[model samples]
Target: MRNAGLGSWPHRRARMAPKREAFSYDGVSTTYEEVAVRTTKLARRLEELGVRPGDRVSYLGANHPSFAETMFATHQLGAIFVPLNFRLSPAEINYQLADCGARVLIHAPSHQVEHERAISLDSYEDWLAGGSEEPLDVPVTIDEPALILYTSGTTGRPKGAVLSHANLLWNTFNLMIGVDVTTDDIALVAAPLFHVAALTQTLLPTFIKGGHSVITPRWDVDECLNLIEGYGVTWMFGVSTMYADLAASPRWPTADLSALRVLLCGGASVPDAVIHTYQERGLVFCQGYGLTETAPGATFLEAADSVRKAGSAGTPVFFTDVRLADTGEIEVQGPNVTPGYWNDPVATAAAFTEDGWFRTGDIGRLDDGHLYVVDRLKDMFISGGENVYPAEVENAITDHPDVAEVAVVGVPDERWGEVGRAFVRPRAGAAVDAAGLREFLLPRLAKYKIPVHVEVVTELPRTGSGKVLKPALRRLPLAPAVSPENAPGR
Candidate 1:
């Protein structure tokens, strides 16, 4: 009596607001009715391409209307959607495609030459011309796999986190209630749709409410401002770094961002300065925390707490149950949590406890039910038997006016088992000296927690998701103590 597959959401949405604008990009708008109709034709075309129920349909392209359309179409046939990051190398993309044993590949025209297995998004018209627009009567249920989103896997080889239709739906509901998404909301999908946050938090919830969404191939501050003013975007989600970049934009002050009611910040802990900047513009920057395994909506610092609990990731979402493990690693139990990695039982078993609670790998604590994220357990270091969390060190280091970005890593030391090394990126037109930074941190953090060695870099290497790659940082040679700040900016 119940149809839980995500494929049915668009059909249901069309009934509520057929003529409503469902999506827009690069001046083209598609209504709910149009999406419903086109998705069926696209589904039929995919069927013709031999994608069957439970088979994987991969998309390797930048954000586009066709990407969303293809996703829903795959859902229509009870197939799983695999959206590859366009920024990844072809080898990386091909690894996922083959790992999932994808039935077919749909990619942007520009990437088609690099991936011969993929059919260009431009060829959709020709492919669908002869296909029938019949709705598939597949037996896909809410508990079945809906998507296979690969984690950044800085800790190990990238593993596909299998998210079910139920996981996606539950997460959407959790965010809608926690984030206060409304039917009139126009959400901007600025982050890569391949990630769960931009899709589950922004796109899915808005779709269910018959709201509007704008997709972009990449994140651009100027174009984002244009969309906010032009489309009347009421909500958006970005990493703390992205928010800082926008605050630095020349047009940010006068950009008519009055329509933006909620700004969701995640991926990393936002600095107090970035929060204050948006508050000046009359907006509440909601900070959140989650992983791909949790469908990405585990916690959200409410608008009211944006200032009150500036550094916290906030309370757990409605359905998520969060607790601290004996070792301080965050553990979560919820319907939104992923079942496990695809086809890797050993890894899956290792991810959860015997009682089935998923270990988050990141060390954190709860204060009155509000979660405060510490650094990753693997990234934590022991200096002469004392625990050193990198996040705490980074927070203290960035407090200096000259510091722009910073990453702390633990390296092997002969005296101590491991020691902290600080890499600082100075703000533009600003200068920071190791001697000055050492004096600055002396007051902010415990002497033992301070990095033994300090170095300056123009920029820190980051993953596509905006995570600092500590592994890459570890590869750089470290000096005995203070290395003079690299004054030359890249």
Candidate 2:
């Protein structure tokens, strides 16, 4: 039988050790039995709110124990859980809610006022007060949809990816065997639970292992360090930017990270220098690559291969097939793959190939079984008839000694059709100029591949998960285009 819900997982854990801690946040802790009771009550509350089986229930909140409880509760009733990005604007959240045809929205009190209309779970005591605590009859099949995660929509409007219970369960089990998670493990969940990266890599795996989860309210570097020490956090997941901030934080080096056994970084590529910095400190750093469509974990560079693979996103997880199309697009197929986009039949049809492989818009190449991401296919542009991948130029620029961060995008060019433009954040206490950057990258990149313009900024605009918002960058007013000789491009 497939293990997909609390009914089976909780019963198995209760027989093994019901008293063991299953989750912790702030000072509150919940065991398997406690989780079961709360979820049962919440399920009843959801039913009282008129949420029937297969109905979409939206959640707009930060990462907390309640979020996980609510997700499980929704699952118990065979309802689809749509966790909205807490950082998105109300309109963005509303778009997703309406797109999914959500029947009810359960939000935390902190975010209740922010949402135009939402039922606060913090005030749910009154609602559940009169409701029954008995578990709702769960008729969930392995193939039933469980989650509707909206993509970041970097290229266009976001699309909700529908993930089945089997997709999550199988992915969680795959992560367990691939990462070797144990019951004694305590996972530090710093990434937003709304993202599939956190949900699949940390939350689901922790529950499946009967392990403890330390939920952080937000991603504060010092607070994250403190939580690691406070809860004896054994494993954690963060993006490359988070790791960079943590490594450069004042609390690091002095902070006791001895309890940490693994640190997974992804959502974007990691700098080689950053990887070396962690290795020099005896930290195990692994990198992974996936999209919301793949239940967020298609490939993972194991700790053992971290140094060897360097910048690779590692091999595909068990049962997942990762292939590079002849056109250089990444294609994925497996049980973990999402069924399709919600209410987007045209997009759903366009997303898959003739044989059913999902065409990931990413451009990548395989070197001895390891995936090296070149860039996003959509992010690539032709400059002076030469193909320019923004990620490549951005990576090169970020590697500069005085550069702290960078983003590369193509701008409308009346002469060349399009030209590469770079926005950079220089390291503190260091001096960097556009001319100097041009000189720095001139030898490292092709003549046409070098950015035609460079702008220094305090920081690049990013999503909550640290992905560079190139669309926002594109909206900025045009700057003077520079040529290879440090003059106007022309």
Candidate 3:
């Protein structure tokens, strides 16, 4: 196989296994050769449409085989690929498309009505139907931008992080150094391609190894389990919430999960219980941490340390540097670090330090070289002059047997300035109330760290990648604050 480099993945795959199955979805299979051929044609079609080097080609769709094809095609033309989160509102999507100045927008047939303002690649299927099966020769520099993935932007408008071809290529190599993947391996890609976690961490790595990718349009627990069992899937990656749901499902133990080898969980703090549950089932579960700015992967929990370093995001991946500011913010610098936010120099300058470290905005600490994420610096709050980190509080609450999921936020309080409030989702078939949960947390957390108000909810708002939308929680109404006379320890 040839060396890994920018615009070299498809070429490498074609040489490694031209006729081998590269992707499968809904009973449709595309070989490495076919993918290469289609992508080449798509690139020509894009060029005919006036897409030039540095132009952005945006895509809004669920996980599908075409999504991968479009990504490779965009790279084939030296065009930037911008993937929009399907979960975002139309207005939010419009803002991103306009912000990126995308010349062409490719979307799923289902989203055609919602995104009709731009040209659709699906509509031009016939144009791409027949073209040169030969590969389109395009030159790409290592420093050239390959993709633009928007941050979740829980606090403000999302920023477009420009990931260079070298950024992604090196990050994939970093992942391969840690995780052993082979051509015989089959990866289950249930997460959305819009996020770097799914794109760079899972899909790109699988492609680099000449492995097969099994894509699911969306996350349906039963469907995911069925596909894993039927396709003999060997690897999978998902958010902590997805892992918790799969572990808690009644069908999990009975399903043929024996084929599954590695399960990666990230995007949020993972509960210890979820890790233990998967361990009991003989599945190896590892935690990973990264941001869009870092090409999505900076650290990974090694299999040897999976249990010993439970709840930790582990050490930085190869070629990545991690440091903590005096204020406790985690700063990262490495090849995988993004060049900058596209067309937003002011925000881009603000995201980095004078020394060139990218401010992750996440507060964490390193213990003996292992990274432990505490909470987002923006999520930290002050109540009555006391500092509180929500992750610390949420961890304590989720440890409770009855609590299935929990999110902590600061709510307005007249006397204390701001107080902690928790929104909890109880375990299935478990009876839990505010008082019981509060009592359960009292001994586990400090007085100020414990939530004063608890609300039972069916579900919590989350981003496409399953991260808790704390900003949405902040907008929700909080219960009336307790009077000074009745407040605890007042």
List the global CA lDDT of all models. Answer: 0.81, 0.79, 0.79
TM-score of 1: 0.79
Off by over 4 Å in 2: 1-12, 112-117, 380-490
lDDT of 2 by residue, 1-490 (tens): 2435533465466557788898888878889887777777877877877778789888888888778877887887888999987655455567678888888787877664343336786776676566677655666688988899886443336678899888888788668767879999999998889878888899789887889998987788888888899888999888766787788888877998888888887676777888998888888889888888888788888878988888899999887989999999999999999899888888899899999999888899999999998766678665432345676677678879999988888886644546788888889988778888887776555456677788888988889999989899999999676544542221
Where does candidate 3 stray beyond 4 Å?
Answer: 1-6, 113-124, 152-155, 380-490
* TM-score preference between candidates 1 and 3, better one: 1
Mind giving the per-residue lDDT tens digits that candidate 1 earns over 253-312? 788888889999776666687788888878988989888899988888888888788778
lDDT tens per residue, model 3, 1-490: 2222344567668877899889999988889988877888887777777888889989888888878887888887788999987655565577788889888888876665344335555665686786566656666777888898876343345678899989998898888887888888999998778878888888999998889999998878899999999999999888765676687788987999988889987777667887888889888888988887898788889888887888889899988989899999999999999989888898889899999999988899899799998767677665543446676677767888988988989876644546788898999998777767767765554465567777888899999999999999999877664333323221
**lDDT, model 2:** 0.79
Clashing pairs in 2: none
Q: Candidate 3 clash total?
A: 0
Estimated TM-score for each candidate: 0.79, 0.77, 0.77
lDDT of 1: 0.81
- Screening candidate 1 with a backbone cut-off below 3 angstroms (N, C-alpha, C), the clashing residue pairs are none
Task: By lDDT, rank the candidates, best first.
Answer: 1, 3, 2
